[model samples]
Target: MVNLDSSIAFLIYITAVSSAAAGVTEACKSVIPFLATDYEARNDCWEDHNHAARLNHYKRFFNLLISVVAAGVIFGVMGLDPALILTGAEKVYVEDSWEVGTWLWGIVAVFGSPFFASLLKIVEGFKQSVNNNLPPNRPRQKVTGPRE
Candidate 1:
């Protein structure tokens, strides 16, 4: 019989690795310049806009991953069987329970949530940096006055 806690722990471990990978990928992507060839230092909304869009894209993905992993942790700690997750009127029990990896996985789950949250904060900070480095937008302002 498979142990519910162990299974959930394994799932949490998997989620942690995946989340970490996604975070690193996002960090790398954030470093690439949108205007690689531009030397004139012109202020273009398109470039800033594109960078913002990409940052937002990774942000959403990372947030979703964290949410899923957090859900896995919740289920695991509650002692709910993964097998019972699908069936409405079914229950599963385990006797032998847990192998060598279960404790390690549980430990990862306990730490992974905060780690992922910190990663999310780093990404947000990178996004803010991009925003700050972007040139300010200046357009023509309307003027109304009586003829002298």
Candidate 2:
């Protein structure tokens, strides 16, 4: 039911929204360690890092922070729920999505990508933990003195 031009515009809008999400996420990744008393990690993750990277990070960080704040306002003013965009897997009740409007889907796509990225990171950690706990396949070789 939505116009083609509006649908395209929504796509672009979400792209900006998602990147703004990424900026907030990145800012938190760097700042949270320091706030949580993880001094060693904080030092390694932020204090010991290259200066150029941190500068670039802050530039996007502040921009996206402001961007998403506005997006949240749009969400409130429009009275649309973005979470509906995430229900692609559900066959039932999804028909209502079309009636709900493209704006809802647009908002979700913009905000959802960051949450998706975070979810991936958490999954990666779980995988690494599982891999680390597996026992060695073979017995360790015995150490021997140097031959004459």
lDDT, candidate 1, 70-104, per-residue tens: 44444344444433432322443323225323334
**lDDT for position 27 in model 1:** 53
Looking at model 1, the pairs that clash are none
Candidate 2 lDDT tens digits, 123-145? 55555666689653577898999
Clashing pairs in 2: none
lDDT of 1: 0.48
Residue 74 of model 1: what lDDT?
44
Task: List candidate 2 stretches off by more than 4 Å.
Answer: 34-107, 110-148
